[model samples]
Target: MDFLELVKKRRSVRAYQNKSIPDRELSKILEAARLAPSGFNAQAYKIIVIKDEKSREKLGELAKQPYISKAPIILAAVNTKLDDKYSPLDIAIALDHIMLAAAELGIGTVFVGAYHNEEIRDFVGAPNTAEMVALMPLGYPADKEIAKKRKEISELISQEKF
Candidate 1:
């Protein structure tokens, strides 16, 4: 439960158990997002929680990630205000908070980025003005451990210059 350990433990969980996440736990995860820092404190985002099986299936099909439908819940992280400069970054930070909270609570999540915009908007009733930043599939993981291969710090960091 150390922060670094929690970061190391987080992974893109593709396989999930067919179990429901308790509402209290889900609320805690959302609270983490709610507390996340946003540019200018303009929390211009909305998380659309999809619990219906049919909706999940449609989203999975639209996103071309069938594994998403298997999740107990799917959250559409959207930029409600659609600010060109800060919307994407703000939404990402919020979802990161959600994911880390889920990891700490033993729930699993995957941040899905690629999807069909028009199809998803129509299916999910997302406003035409809003932007879908990412999709998150949340549930208990079927695979408990994921050995992630990360780049060495030496390969990634720069000392006062790129």
Candidate 2:
């Protein structure tokens, strides 16, 4: 599919099937994240792949989103350079790449931003130098319906000045 179509098809999946993503597809998703651009090429981030059911359960509980544990994998995007102001943006871009890649492969994902930071960081064993920025749950989508209402291009774009 074309990039625009792919982008349109990408949605925040909340329900997922009990299925595992193939290694090939998973590799592609991770590769997309790895290739994401960062400010000044400082890719100060790390993606912690969580596949253990117990850990996912704990994370889901901490996030107060039980649906999170339903997915087969949960990717934790971490900013490794806490001192760098752009680290969070870099991590967000990487996560976006992962979401797009997964959508292309017929997989589903959701960007999870609400959660207990310190608890999750400690549970995932992330170093003190790193901070968890976001969590993404990935798997075959159990809910296929997409009902996205977006703003028109005219309403979203502006001329030289606002």
Each model's TM-score, in the order given?
0.95, 0.95
Model 1, which residues run further than 4 Å from truth? none
For candidate 1, what is the lDDT? 0.89
Please list the Cα RMSD from the true structure of every candidate, rounded to 1 decimal place.
1.3, 1.3
Off by over 4 Å in 2: 114-116
In order, candidate lDDTs are 0.89, 0.89
Q: Considering only N, C-alpha and C atoms within 3 Å, which residue pairs clash in candidate 2?
A: none
lDDT of 1 by residue, 1-162 (tens): 899999988888999998999999999999999999988998897898999999999889999999999999999987778645787898899999999999999999989994337678667788888877789999999987667898999899989998
TM-score of 1: 0.95
lDDT of 2 by residue, 98-133 (tens): 999999999999999943388788788988767788
